[model samples]
Target: MHLYGCPMTRSTRVAWVLEEAGLDYHYTVIDLKSGEGFKPPFINLNPSGKVPALVDGDLILTESAAIGIYIADKVPAAGLIPAVGTSERALHDQWCFFASSELEQPLWLMAKHTFAFPPDQRCPAVLPSAEWEFKRQLKVLAQGLGDKTFILGEQFTVADVLLSHILTWATRGLKMDLGDEKLEAYRQRTQARPALAKAREREAHEAALKAQAQ
Candidate 1:
């Protein structure tokens, strides 16, 4: 298995999941900032020209959430997900969708307007609305979390991975107020995991290697 990624992006989610599953995989660095992702070689793998594309022998998967789920399901013994037909598994998929769509949407919108877009095309007006929407959505997530150690009650499944990672992104990238102490603590707890640390360390190491080569 191989995963292509750029540091400080959604690809970290995939890396984290792979690390948690204790899977051995190749990590390829794609310089998205340098327009490397738009080139034919990488584009051929994911026509969308996105980071966090996974290649597993004959199968190529794009999108960070899909890659994370695939990795988790592939390694069921790691217990990253609930039983196949259980209600917990349904909740797991639900939160993953919520994180990727409801939570991540505004964050990406804010990012696109703030820096992802070319200066002339950026809309400063979008930031306020995006931040507002993010806060509103964050409240729903906080209520969902309640007092559970993880999303589905106790086990640290990929649902927590998906949600926690996006919360981290919102906290660090958008500067939006998470508005709940428990949520913040939850983020801290998930990030403090050894697998997450390894993923981050690997990302930093690969990023540094790329920097030196440049």
Candidate 2:
């Protein structure tokens, strides 16, 4: 298996899943700065031209959420997901959509205004608005988390892998003032996971390799 990614990119999703599943896969660095990720070759692998594309032999997958679910299903022994038809599985799907639709959407807006767009084209006025919307969404998520150690009670499911990562980045980038203490503690717990720790280590190593070649 191989994952194409760059440090600080969406590729963190695949990297974290790989650790969670105890899978050793090859990491291919796609230099987004030099436009390597958007070219025909990488675009062929992921038509969306996004980072965090995964290739497991003939099964080539794009979209971080799809990749996360695929990995969890493939490694059921890892317990990243609940059994099919179970209530927990249903909840996983529910929260997955909530994370992508409710939480992540505003973060994308904030990112566009803050960095992806140029100073002139960027809409600074809308940034505060996006942050407000994201904060509102996070409050709902905090309530859903309740007193559970993970998204589905005490067990760590693949949903947490995706949602937690999104929340962590949103917190850092959106300056997410999680007014809710539950959400803040949840964020801290997910960020401190061993899987995330290992992925950061690998990302640092890959970054050093890129720097030395420059």
- How accurate locally, in lDDT, is each candidate? 0.89, 0.84
lDDT of each residue in 23-142, candidate 1, tens digit only: 998888999988989997999999888898999999999988888888899999999988789988888999999998898899899888988889999999988888888889888988
Question: Model 2 over residues 67-101: C-alpha lDDT tens digits?
Answer: 88899998999998888898889999898888878
Clashes of 1: 0
| Model 2 global lDDT (CA atoms, 0 to 1) | 0.84
Model 1: ten consecutive residues of lowest lDDT? 170-179
**Which 10 consecutive positions of candidate 2 have the poorest summed lDDT?**
170-179
User: Which residue pairs come into collision in candidate 1?
Assistant: none
Question: What's the CA RMSD of model 2 in angstroms?
Answer: 1.5
Top model by lDDT, which number?
1
State the TM-score for model 2.
0.93
